[model samples]
Target: MKPFLCAAILSVLPFTASAAPSSSEVVESFIQAYNQHDVGLMVSHTTDNVTWMHVTGKKVKVETSTKAEFGAAMTDYFESLKGANATILDIMESGSYVSTVERVTWDNDGEQLSQCSIGTFRVTEGKLAEFWYFPAHACDELSLKPEVAPEVGVLQQTQY
Candidate 1:
């Protein structure tokens, strides 16, 4: 009888989805691992079939597809650029997606070089599932430039 009563109470109680890492948390952790140059730790934060891409003007490039591939590519990159680093300049969170502007810098021939890119990441089930990167630009150059205002009488003189 007690077992039956307990079961009835449990059935009436509300239940929620298991506690999963938030989209921002997953993306942030991945970047943190990348800054540490820990490929294994970075892979641990991604799905087995993770994907990475770069979306340029009218073109898309697949950078990595599988976890093993990602690890290998990162390993090779880290070897060539030992002290390169990435910093998140801005970020936005929406549902299962996290978008961030990343500032990456490295030294070349005693000169420091930096670039910025926009990346949108999708996290599923507490893991980074996929991501896309916009074209990179020099850090000092804004990806979007300010538009100049049209002349006061230019539009008025023009016909449709």
Candidate 2:
């Protein structure tokens, strides 16, 4: 009986692992398509009503765009820029949402610029439904940090 159970579990393991793409995998594929300037591949990962919100690090300001609009903007950006690339630092997933920390660089004319940012994506039905971008500093402030709490007899406590 023990050997039979082990064989059954082993047979199901591969199927379980390949059942569906994780949220992180979907986001990673989108990022790879974006870096390659493959608009079709990037759009294939999103739904028709996909929305993107871009935060400019200003005081409570966000620019919103739809799937078609974002595609056009990305096309223009790729055409105008000399080169662009993205390096993913971390990826986290919870439920249908995936968040990534990335360093993105672009070359324009003879100058290069780079910035670190956090991108949060909502994937539904195996397609991207929404996304939000925030500067790394903003995400840093929101990150979980340990704070010394001498009074609680604890060496450190998580600060939200």
Candidate 3:
């Protein structure tokens, strides 16, 4: 009788579904496209009236007047990369918001500069509507690896 009770309880145990993809996935997709230098997919994830801002509070209003114009702008940015690749090291998600630490590798006058950066994205209805990005800085010599590779960096508290 005890064995039968144990079996019944075990059978009744709930099975949890796999964790759904966080908004970070959207960011990751963008990162991959940026790395691969694919602009089409990068802009497709963004809504038409996307607002991309930087840490300094500078804003770009991407009201392309038409979807085609929007796509062209994205393509132009990608083409301008000239082999620049971005790597996403850490990502954390809360509700519709996803934050990630990234490293961007680009060249200037034959010198290679790898800058560490952090970006947060606000997602709505499966689209990334807006985002805020802190400027990238030179990495410390002691910490060779970017924070996002194995673990996520802790972010300061801010309004969502």
Candidate 4:
């Protein structure tokens, strides 16, 4: 009977592990929902007390303190941006944290802004518990341009 019980538990373990989405997967799916402008779907991927923070230079401000606030803020943002879009340029996942470099574009009337930004999210139990957005770096900024040496022509950046 002991041997049979152990085998039964072992057989069900894989299915249990597969039941919940990984932390990174949840973050990525939430971003997809954002692109679709589905505020409800976005909130569904976050915890009840989910928090969103914006990092501006030396200051960090809480943009949204709860899931309800997040949904309301997103609704307002979608209306203001009209057709804003975010493209994930790169992403990395470690443990419960997921970080992404994204290109965001939006048009405000006749003015358009395109910027690259870094966002980090902490997910718990397959739901985003909190997220932070770094200050935007314009996509066309000199730092993003390829580096070059005047004498060597093309220069390879060295890693420290």
Candidate 5:
């Protein structure tokens, strides 16, 4: 009876593993798409109704939109920046939630602007269902020095 029960559990283990992409994988794909500035590819990894929340520590701004609306926003943002790129420094996953520390650099009419932030994402069914963004600094820590400070910062509490 013990051996039979062990066999049964072993047989069900594979099926019990989630069919959805791992939280790290989902975040990796999203970051890759973002680095390429491929809005379509980015949106493709999101649910039809995705909720994005930008938390400023003081207030939370929520935007619940369809994939189309999200895609449009991405397009507009890219256009405004001329060209932007993101680098994921670290990624941590817990259950279905993935959190990342990233630095984004953009050309704003030849003046480059770079900022670091923490982004938390909730992935469901292999797609992003929700996201929360928290800026690491209240103001852009701009520097023209040749040596740039490391972007990695301690993860603060998020409104997750």
Candidate 6:
């Protein structure tokens, strides 16, 4: 009976991860908020101490730990979403974490402001704790250039 129960639990466990959102849900939520240009929603899923990293040389460097700081960091990114669009290509899950491959393109008044980004996100505790992004390679000048752009307005942001 004990072995049978264990197998049942294991089989059902994988279904839970598949049925509902899992870590990938957290990332998808964040992207949804970003797509909607909502800053508050983006921060809601994050821990008080969130760590954000970029493929660029820039580092947020934990300066403080507070929701206001987190909100501020989100502000820096959200405000830039004048016409930003985030498209998720794929998601890879590993235990309590998920990696998402995505592309982001921002356009204003028929002119492309930034190129698409080849980005990845890490989710923890059903919240976004760490984010890593790389600029997607583009072919035309109309595309925005990719940079190591990690801008967390809030201070004391930690990496999970």
Cα error of candidate 6 at position 152, Å = 49
Question: Clashing residue pairs, candidate 1?
Answer: none
**lDDT scores of the candidates, listed in order:** 0.90, 0.81, 0.72, 0.89, 0.84, 0.68
Please tell me which predicted candidate would have the highest lDDT against the true structure: 1
Looking at model 3, which ten-residue stretch has the lowest summed lDDT?
59-68
> Tens digit of lDDT per residue, candidate 1, span 57-104?
999899999999999999999999867899998889999999999999
Candidate 1: C-alpha lDDT: 0.90
Residue-wise C-alpha lDDT for candidate 4, range 1-160, written one tens digit per residue: 9999999999999988776787778988998998899999999999999999999989999999999999999999998887788888878899999999888888877888788989999999889999999988877662544667588676788996
Please give the distance, in angstroms, between residue 144's alpha carbon in candidate 1 and its true position after superposition. Answer: 9.8
The lDDT, on a scale of 0 to 1, for candidate 6 is 0.68
Which 10-residue span in candidate 1 carries the lowest summed lDDT?
Answer: 12-21
Writing each residue's lDDT as its tens digit, candidate 2 over 33-128 gives 989989888889989888877766564333435678778877887888657888887789999999888877887677877777888999998889
In order, what is each prediction's RMSD in angstroms? 6.3, 6.4, 9.7, 6.3, 9.6, 13.6
- Quality of model 5 by C-alpha lDDT: 0.84
Error in Å for residue 145 of model 2: 9.2
Candidate 3 ranges beyond 4 A from true positions = 1-20, 57-73, 141-160
* Deviation (Å) of 51 in candidate 4: 0.6
Q: List, residue by residue over 74-108, the lDDT tens digit for candidate 6.
A: 67766765678777766777877677656667777
The window of 10 residues in a row where model 5 has the poorest summed lDDT is 136-145
**What local lDDT does model 6 show for residue 93?**
78
Q: Candidate 5's residue-wise lDDT over 1-160, tens digit each?
A: 9999999999999998857678899889998998888999999999999988899869988765678888888888888876688887668899999998788888877798878888999999899999999966422453324766777886678897
TM-scores, one per candidate: 0.76, 0.69, 0.63, 0.76, 0.70, 0.60
Q: What TM-score quantifies how close candidate 1 is to the native fold?
A: 0.76
lDDT of 3: 0.72
- Backbone clash count for every predicted candidate, in the order shown: 0, 0, 2, 0, 0, 11
